[model samples]
Target chain A: MKKLINKPENFVDEMIEGIILAHPDMVRTPGEDKRIMVRADAPRKDRVGIVTGGGSGHLPLFKGYVGAGLCSAVAIGNVFSSPSSDQIFQATKAVDGGAGVLYLYGNYGGDVFNFDLAADLAELEDIETLTVLGRDDVASQPKERSADRRGVAGIIFAYKAAGAAAERGDSLKEVAAAAEDIIENTATMGIGLSPTILPTTGKASFDLPDGEMEIGIGIHGEPGIHRGALETADEVAERLMRPLVEDLGLSSGDRIAVLVNGMGATPLEELYVLYRKVHRIAEELGLTVEKRYVGEYATSLEMAGASLSLLKLDDERLALLNAPASSPFFREG
Target chain B: MKKLINKPENFVDEMIEGIILAHPDMVRTPGEDKRIMVRADAPRKDRVGIVTGGGSGHLPLFKGYVGAGLCSAVAIGNVFSSPSSDQIFQATKAVDGGAGVLYLYGNYGGDVFNFDLAADLAELEDIETLTVLGRDDVASQPKERSADRRGVAGIIFAYKAAGAAAERGDSLKEVAAAAEDIIENTATMGIGLSPTILPTTGKASFDLPDGEMEIGIGIHGEPGIHRGALETADEVAERLMRPLVEDLGLSSGDRIAVLVNGMGATPLEELYVLYRKVHRIAEELGLTVEKRYVGEYATSLEMAGASLSLLKLDDERLALLNAPASSPFFREG
Candidate 1:
C-alpha cells in the first residue's frame, strides 16, 4: 500500500497527537484520554456547549469543527467506526458550561446509539443534554422518510448555525432548535469516481471497475442510488443539484448557501469545474446563491469524487454564517 | 480517463469562471480579459501593488493569494504553462497604485521569460515593476548553486511576507526585498508516491513503480535526489526534516515556521501523522516551531505525495506571518 502511515493501529492516536501539537492555541485534549478534544477555552460559564463526535478519517468534519464558535468539543473514533459512549460522555463533561450541552453529529446507527448513551450518562450528573442528528443526504432515503437519510457534508450548516447560537449565550433548547432547523433545510448528494482505502485493513473501502462511477455514495462507502459509467462535470452537477433544490422546495426567490466539496483525491481545479456548472444551474433556476464554499470540507480518505450541498437560507442562517469564527482548518467572517 | 471535465481545453477557463462566480465579493476581472484577476479593491492609493502568476494547476499558489493583505492580482495560464506577457502586463497595470508594482512568482523558465517580457511592457507604459523569483527547492541544486534551484511550495513564504510589506504602503523596493529575504531563508523538499495525470494529455506526469517513492521530487515531476521503496511516515518525515533543518543552518536558539503541504491526493490525516514526527524532531533539536501551517498550499493536480518547508523565522518574519490576510483559499490572523 502507498499510505504514508506507520503501524495501522496507531493511525488515529498519532493523528490526534499531531493535531494537539500543531494547534495548541485552538484545541487541546480535555483530559488524560487524548481521544476527546475540546476548544482550549472551553467550558465558558453561562454558555450552552456544543459537542460533536464521529469516526476518524473525515478531517474538518467531526474534530475540525471544534472551536470557539463551532463545536466546543469532539469525541474521536477509529477510521469509519463510532466513538465509544464513555468517550462521548467525556467530551460532554469537558465542554459543559452551567447552561447545558447539545449533542450534534451525523445520523448513523452506531453514532446515534453512542451519543444517546452519552446523553443518558450526562443526565446522571445533572447535566441537561439534547440530541440533534444531521440528516441531509437526500439519496439515502425518500423525502417521506427524510429522518432516515444519512448526513454528509451538509452537517457543516448545522454546525455553523447552531454554534453561532451557542456562542451568543443561547439556551440549550434554542441551540437544539437552531440545529434542527438547519438540518431540516439542508440537502446533499455525492458522486464517487474511486473508493477510499482503509489504513487498518490496507484495503479499498469499496470496489468498482476502473472507469465506472457511483452516484449518491455515503462517506463510509455505503451503496448509493446509481452505479454506472462516469459522467461529465456538468452532468454530475445537474444530477446532484436538481434533487437538492427539489428536496428543499426551493423556489425562484430563494436564497441559498452552496458547498461544492471534494471527497479526497479530486483536484480543487475539478471542484471549481463542478461549482461552475452548479452556479449556472442555480441561476437558471432563478435561485440566488448568497454564500458558496468550494473546497475539501468533508472527505473519505483518498476517495476521488465530489459532493454538492445546498442549504435553503433565510436572514438568520445567513447572519450566522457570516459571524467571525476561527479554527485550525476553517475560518469565517 | 475519469476526470470530471467536459473538454480538456475548457478546463482553465471553466475553473476561472467558477472562481469569479463563487467569490465575486473578494475578486474580479480587472478588464475584458477574464484571464487576469485582481483583488476586489485593487489600486489602493500609494500602496505597493503585488502581482503574481504561474501555470494553472497550482491553485492558491499563484492566484489564490490575491486578496486583502496578500497579492493584489494574478495572471493565469493553462495547466503547467506560463501566462502570456500581455496578461502579466495587464495585471501589473491593474494593481499599480501611485507607488509601484512587485512581480512575485515561482522560479520556472517559462514564467521567468514571460514576467521579464511583461516588465519591459510595464516600463514602456510608465509602470515601475520589480521582480523577485522564489527559488527555495533545495533538492534542485546544491548550496553553491542555490540561485538556480526550482521554486516549490516555499514560495508561499515570500508571498506572505512581501504581500504584508506592500499592504502597509512600503515602497516597491522594500516589498521585493522582503520577498527576497524570505526566499533566501526558506528551504523545501518533496516526496512523490505516484504521478499526477494531466487533463490535456490524459497521461501520468512521471512513471514510478507501485511501492516506490521519489524523494526530493519537484512539483512538476522533475528529477529528484533519490527513489526507493516507500518508507514509513516517521522515516519519510525524518528524511525530509533533517535536510531542511541543516540547509537553514538552524541551531538550538532558532525559531522556525513549519509547513507540511499536501501535493493533492494525500489525506490530511497522513499529513498530521507526518507533522507529529516533524514536531518531535524540532523539539529534539531545540528548535522552536513558533508558527505552523499544514494543508494543501501548493499542489500538482492529483499527485499522491507531500512536501515539507521550513522558514527560519526572526521577529519580523513571524510578525508578517501573523498579520491578518484573507483570500479565497487562505486566511491568517
Candidate 2:
C-alpha cells in the first residue's frame, strides 16, 4: 500500500493523537485511552448532551462533529470497524450533563449493537440515554423497508439539526425526537467510481472494474443496487436523485437543504459539477433549496464517489440547521 | 481514469457552472464567459480589491477563496493551465473598487506572464494595479535564490493575511507589502506517494511504482528532489520539514502558523498522523505554533500526498490570520 502511515496497527491511535494536538481548543480525550473524544468544553451544565460514534475512516462525521453546538463527544473505532461498548460508555459518561445524553450514529449492525450496549451501561450509572439511528440511503432498501437502509451523508444533516436543538437547551427526549425527525425526512444515495483501500491489509475493500460504476454502495463497501458502465454526470446525478426524491415524496413548493458530498478521492470541482445537476433537477421539480453544502462531509478511505443528500426542511429544522457551529473539520459562519 | 466527470473537455466549464450554482449567494460570473468568477458583493466602495487566479483542478484555491474578508474576484483557467490575459483583465476590471486592485497568485511562469499582461491592460484603462507573486516552496529552490522557488500551499497563507489587510481598508501599497511579507516568510514542501490522473487526458500525470515515494513533488506532477522506497509517516514528515525549517532560518523562539495540507487523495486520518509528527517536530525545534490548519487547503486532482507550510508570524500578521473570514470552502470563527 502506498499510504503515508507508520504502521497499520497504530493508525487509529496516531490519528487521534494528531487530531487532539491540532485542535487543542476544540477536542480532547476523556481518558488516557484516546478512543473517546469529547468536546474541549463539554458537559455544559443543565444541557442535553449529544454523543455519536462509529468507525474512523469517515472523518468529520463522528469526531469532527464533536464541538460547540454539535456533538458533545465521539467514540472512535478502527477504520471501518465499530468502537467497543466500553469506549461508547466512556464518551457518554464524559459528556453527560444533568439533562441527559443522546446517542446518534449510523445504522450499521456493529455500531447499532455496540451503542445499544453503551446505553444499557449508561443506565446503570443513573444517566438517561436515548438512541437515534440514521438510515437514509434510499438504494439500500425499498420505501416500505426504509428502516433497513444504511446511513450515508444524510447523517450530517441529522447531526446539525439535533445538535442545534440540544444547544438550545432541549431535553434528551426532545433532542431524540428532533433527531428522529431528521432521520425520517432525509434521504441519500451515492455512486462509487473506485474502491477504497483498507489500511490494515493495504488492499481494496471491494473490487470495481475500471470504466464501470457502482450505484448506492455503502460507506464501507456494502453492495449497492446495481453495477453498470460509467455514465455522464447528468445521468449519474439523475440516477442518484430519482430514488431519493421519490423516497422523500418531495413535491412542488417543498423546501429542502441539499448536500453534494464527496466520498474521499472525488475532487470538489467534480462535486460542484454534480451539485449543478442536482440543483437544476431540484428547480425543475419546483423544490426550493434553502441551503446547500458541496464538499467532503463523510467519506470512505480515498474512495472516488459522490453522494447526494436532501433534507426536506421544516421551519424548526431549517432554523436549527442554520445555527452557528465550529469544529476541527467543520465550521459555519 | 475513473472519475465522476461527464466529458474531459467540459470538465473545467462544468466545474465552474457547478461552483456558481452551489454558491449563488457567494460568487457569480461577470460576463458570458465563465472564466472570471467574482464575489457576489464585489466592487465595494473604497476597498482595495484582492484578486487571485490559477488553473482548475485545485478546488477551494482561487475560486473557493472569493468571499467576504478573503478575495474579491478570481480568474479561472483550464486544469493545470494558467488563465489567459484577457480573462485576467476582465476580472481586474470587474473588481476594481475605485482605490486599486491587487493581483496575487503563485510564481508559475505562465501565470506570471499572463498576469503581467493583464496588469498592463488594466493600466491602459486607468485602474492602478499592484502585483505580488508567491514563491514559498522551499523544496523548489535554494535559500540563496528563494525567489526562484515555485509557489505551493503557502500561497493560501499569503491570501489569508493580505485579504484581511485589504478588507481592513488598507491602501494598495499596504496590502501589497503585507502580501509580500507573507510570501517572504512562509515555507512549504510536499511528498507524493502516487500520481494524479488528468481528467482531459484520462491518464496519470506521472508514474510511481508500488512501495515507493517522491519527496518535494510539485502540484502538477513536477519532479521532486528525491525518489525512493516509501518511508514511515515520521520519516516522511522529517524529510519534508528539514529543508523548510532550514530555509526559513527558524530558531528556538519563533511563532508560526502551520498548515498540513493534503494533496487530494490522502485521507484526513492519515493527515492527522502526519500532523502528529509535525507538531512534535515543531516542538522539538522550539517553534511556537500560534495557528494550525489541517486539511486539504490546496490540492492536485486526487493525488495521494501532502504538503507542510509554515508562516512565521508577528503581531500584525497574527491578527490578520485570526481575523474573521468566510468563503464557500473556508470559514473562520
> Per-candidate TM vs. native?
0.99, 0.99
- Where does candidate 2 stray beyond 4 Å? none
Over the stretch B1-333, how does candidate 1's per-residue lDDT look in tens digits?
Answer: 668887899999999999999999999999998889999998798999998989998876777889988899999899999999999999999998878899998889999999999999999989999998899999999988999989999988888998888888789899999999999999999999989899998899899888899999999999899999999999999999999988999999799999999999999999999999999999999999999988899999999999999999999999888888999988887
Predicted complexes: DockQ each: 0.82, 0.83
Residue B64 in candidate 2 has what lDDT?
85
- Where model 1 places Cα greater than 4 Å from the true spot, the runs are none
State the lDDT of candidate 2 residue by residue for B1-333, as single tens digits. 778888889989988988888788888898888989988988888899988999988877878889888888999789999999999999988898898999999989999999999999999999999999889887788888998989988998888888899898999999999999999999999999889889988889999887889998999888999999999999999998888888788998998899999999898889999999999999999999899999999999889999999888899989999888888888875
Model 2, span A1-333: residue lDDT tens: 878899899998999999999989888888887989999988888899988989999986778888877899999799988999999999998998889999899999999999999999999999999989899998888899998888888999889888888988888899999999999999999889999999899899999999999999988888899899999999999999988899899999999999999899888888988888999999999999999988889999799998999999999989989998888877764
lDDT of each: 0.92, 0.90
Residue pairs whose backbone atoms clash in candidate 2:
none
